[model samples]
Target: MFMKTFGWSFAISAVALIVAFIYGGLEALILCAILGVLEVSLSFDNAVVNARILERMSAFWQKMFLTVGILIAVVGMRVAFPLLIVGVTANLNPVEAIRLAMEKGSIDDPGSYAYLLHEAHPQIAAFGGIFLLMLFLDFMFEERELRWLGLLERPLAFVGRLNGASLVIGLLVLVASATMVRPGKEIDVLISGILGLVTYFLVRGLGDLFDVDNDGDTDADDAGALAKSATRGVGKAVGKAAFMLFLYLEVIDASFSFDGVIGAFAITSDPIIIALGLGLIGAIFVRSLTVYLVREGTLDDYEYLDHGAHWAIGALALILLLTISVEINEIITGLIGVLFIGSAFISSIVRNKRVTAASLPSVDQLSS
Candidate 1:
């Protein structure tokens, strides 16, 4: 079972090693491998959260996730997205940005392509942070029977019943970030954060409005109706629910990639290196992890795992917001996610054992 699930992961690793060896011999190989590990460590929480979404999707959409979705993850995000950032921020053409990326790494000049990306970091962080913060906040604020953090989550859920509660919190956090960051960068951060929040509301609101579920509360299970509700005309040609789910999954993946993209720079300033090392290979592993979890019913078995991922996402969001003024270590970010997920797994096991023990008949009762 393990081999079937993880066989492709091993193949990817072997391919990466060979690629690294061909490119720059042992040094590049080791660095590439480390970068891959770093990406997986920082993104395990992402896989957990993705499993929740993927489980709800149809098998066809799920297959699309592994196929079409992997292409988006590798090419669209790993290669193109970084160039887009550089183009927009530095006023360079997208093609020019690509040329610069392939030139020879950012070695000679302090004002290279890599440096421009660094300059754009605050705005990037604000956008990604706000988007992810909304995801975390929205999840927590929603009423759920099963909660891992009862003390805080219950109150948040109660408050969530109020209209626009998540927006209020997101705005407050952005406002706080504005105060902390330098005056010159403050407006950029604020605008980015606002856009991020709006984007979340726009996407999430549409999905919720047209969401098809087994709960029986919704009746828009019809493709025609769902398309009308979601995008007016966007989903008419495609399976409406499936199309919406595809977009939702992409947005979720983008939010996760923001940190990975920016953090990859910390390892190497070369865009191609970042793309090859941290970007493509890590994405493969994460997508595989999501599939494995969904297929194995890992979330059902480990009840609190989803809650833990949400909490870890919230922590990451807070850190990114704070990073506008403060520099945080990559190692610390990765460790925080690991701690949350690990703790939750253990808690689930302990709870399951207790429940099993309680259900068993005592020897005295049997004797009686």
Candidate 2:
């Protein structure tokens, strides 16, 4: 399994590297490696969460996620998305934007890429932070009742029934906050929030629609019929769970990519380096880490890991929300996640050891 996944990942990475080499040079290669490592470290929690979801998916879905999903992740978000952002924000023609990004060390030059990012920092923080926070809360407070949605649980369910009034109130809060913080940019923030909320609801609903109760007799014929029925039902379920999963993955990826993309402005504005370097390195590491978590069943063995990650995601989101008024460093945000998850990991090990010891028979007593 590792080899198969790794093989595909390696091939993709190789193609990315070749493209970077042809377009840029040795600098691109070095930067890509560094950015890759940074993205991996920051997104380890993401992998853990994604793995939990992947485990619940059917084999066919799993393959799609590995292949097509990866393409969307690495190419769509890291490459195309950033370029689109730059084009829109900078008002540069696509070719010019690409040229500007490819210019060596353009991101690092003062008053260049960094300047543009600095201007956009407030928006990035607001969007990325809130999205992360939502993810965290959904994981922590929500119970994992939907198998099709996998790790996704019902947050609103935890809170009990949400009437139209409640949805209105939630919308009001999002609107009020966005307006108060950045009145001019309220629309952007509101859109981002709505997207996140909608994605969450769709995933939850799809999970409910497709989830098969384990108690049912799952014989070959029964399973086949169930799958066929599910496929049809799934089509009716407005948002495909697989697609929602892809969207969720993209949202989180965008959130995590914010710091690096913004920071790349600090390095060099060259869009090529930003896209190729970060895309190759950060994107690959995240993908590999996700696969690793799926293969290892890390969440099953380390029950608290998910909790820690969710809490961390929640904290990160809160920090982002706070960014509307105050600036927070990405390093600090990342550290918060690490601390929570690390504590949980250590605690789990200790608990496991204690359980093991308690279960073990005392040799002296046995002999006596």
Write candidate 2's Cα lDDT for 134-238 as tens digits. 565444444454222234334444553443433454466566558657557777777766775665566555555544212232335235434544632422111
Q: Judged by lDDT against the true structure, how good is candidate 2? A: 0.61
Error of 2 at 22 (Å): 6.3
Taking all chains together, the TM-score of candidate 2 against the true structure is 0.73
What digit string (tens of lDDT, one per residue) describes model 1 on residues 280-363? 678888988998997787988999999999999999899888888888987788899999999999999998999899999999
For model 2, the superposed segments whose C-alpha errors exceed 4 Å read 1-26, 90-96, 103-118, 143-183, 212-251, 362-368
In angstroms, how far off is 32's CA in candidate 2?
2.3
